[model samples]
Target: MPVRSPSLVELNAFLAVARAGSFRQAAQELHVTQAAVSRAVLRLEQELGQAVLARSAGGVSLTPAGTQLRQLVEKPVAALQAAAVRMRKTPERLRLRLSVVTSLGALWLMPRLEAFHLLHPEVEIEFRQYHHDEDFTRDDIDLWIAIKRSAPQRWPRHIAAQYLIGREVVAVCTHERARTAQTAPLLLAQPLLYHSNFPDNWALWAQAQGAKLPLQRKGAGFDLVMNLIEAARSGMGVAIVQQCLAEADLASGRLVIPVPGSASTGRGYFLCRRRAQDAHPAAELFAQWLMQQAGAPPTV
Candidate 1:
């Protein structure tokens, strides 16, 4: 018997689940509910009369049939999505989708967006949070504010990349935590916490400071820099944080910059988008406003 065609929603849900390996994560990726994703996958399984995914305590894995289906439909679905993007009629209202790195979005931009809304009440911004490891080239998103580690020049050539803030980092901890740093080499013996994305941050900062920091795998690590900041502010440990994001905390006395010299991690946050002509007008407006907000010069 021929494999019956699955609904587009079912196929999309299955693909998201397969890529993420968890229905909850897939729902997040698809911006849908976990139950909705589960239902779609179940409907797809029933339509196929076979299990496509193997769910376990660890997570989810693709079955043989799932693997085959993914190999067949992934490119087609991507093309379909791209085609839909191209086919969308430009809305009369100036609206655009902007994907922002999670930490920056929450700590940096979220506070400053009211100004943008006031400046361009005609423009509407749809916000999405992006992760470090995920694909960044979705056509549906009009702009991306992302962190680039090195050679920011080559990222997305032929596109606009305005480096908002140079990756200037500082060692920060609550004021009370600094008093207990008797351990030699500065904060090494403390309950050192870090954002998981930059596991070598402490080592890098130490290296930049002309000190040796042994590889450390101990203590709490968080995915979001905001959480790392919270943990540090709660006196959990010293965290190497991006200075731009930690400015408010440092100013408000929530977090204290304990380290003497700030280290440049060679990472920078960039405001990126398609070419001006090809980009949404609202995205361009937001991008320009954002550059001004960061006090970074606009790029052509």
Candidate 2:
């Protein structure tokens, strides 16, 4: 009997297909074709003389052998990619990658980021608008600004998070609607706009006011806060949106907070990072600048 040496190219192809569980997706990642991906996997499995995957109606699944190989490959593949990225970096300038929810990205961070850039001309800021579900730590994101429960134990040990702002839900509507609502249907009777993450927001606000919320009475639902605010601004409905998101509109007299109440949802915007010690120099500087901005007296 003769031993056969494994092919790294075929092994990589096999791993990609296994991880993605689809030949086409793996091919896309490798910049090859589905046929090529299949051929590579077949070659790898033939050389090993073992069935690495099981064919199924739904898709492909790794056999015990394939599972072991995938486990072995994932770490090295990730490490290689990380190494390649690190090798290319010359560190001439400080760069920070920030992951922020869309609304906060528009409402708060963007408006103030210019000042930070002006102060630290050498530091470059990179912003990626993200949704709520994505994990900032896993993506190698430098910093994450989100509304998260303030539970230290629930998060990973490598990540450090802090409460940045006290959450406030304000009843906001277009200025015209606010002026008209002072006499017509009560604030509670106004059409409700809902954000996916805060469906019970109106109810919570009502509860804070010692009244049963009528949130279930049918209304428009928006997946994004910006859309919801735009709907309110268009006089389509009234929304109980976050005060921070509504600040500019409120100040510009485009929107008005006719109701006077704040509900503590036990949630607030938090800054999360994977151990501040390893943070990018630009990220650290931005964090410090944000803290100073937060602590400074409200000029507006």
**Best candidate per TM-score, number?**
2
Per-residue C-alpha lDDT of model 2 across residues 1-300, encoded as one tens digit per residue = 765766767877887677557787677657677899899899888988898888788998999999998777755654554344345557356678788777777887778877877776667677776766755555657788866643232556556566676476878898777765553237777787878776878887878877666534656889888899999999997887878778788878888887677787767787777643342556655665776676654333
Residue-wise C-alpha lDDT for candidate 1, range 1-300, written one tens digit per residue: 975689899999999788667897677656678999999999999999999999899999999999999989976876575445445587356787888888788788887888777766667788866756634566777888888865433665335566788577778898888777534375676777887877767777777777767555356899888889988888888888887788778878888766577777777798766542352556645655675678742111
Computed on alpha carbons, the lDDT of every model, listed in order, comes to: 0.75, 0.72
Poorest 10 consecutive residues of model 1 by lDDT?
A: 275-284
- What candidate 2 gets wrong by more than 4 Å, as runs, is 1-92, 129-131, 149-153, 180-185, 276-279, 296-300
Judging by lDDT against the true structure, name the best candidate: 1
Task: List RMSD in Å for every model shown.
Answer: 15.7, 15.3
Q: After superposition, how far is residue 53 of candidate 1 from its true place, in Å?
A: 59
Summing lDDT over every window of 10 consecutive residues in candidate 2, give the lowest-scoring window. Answer: 78-87
lDDT comparing candidate 2 with the true structure: 0.72
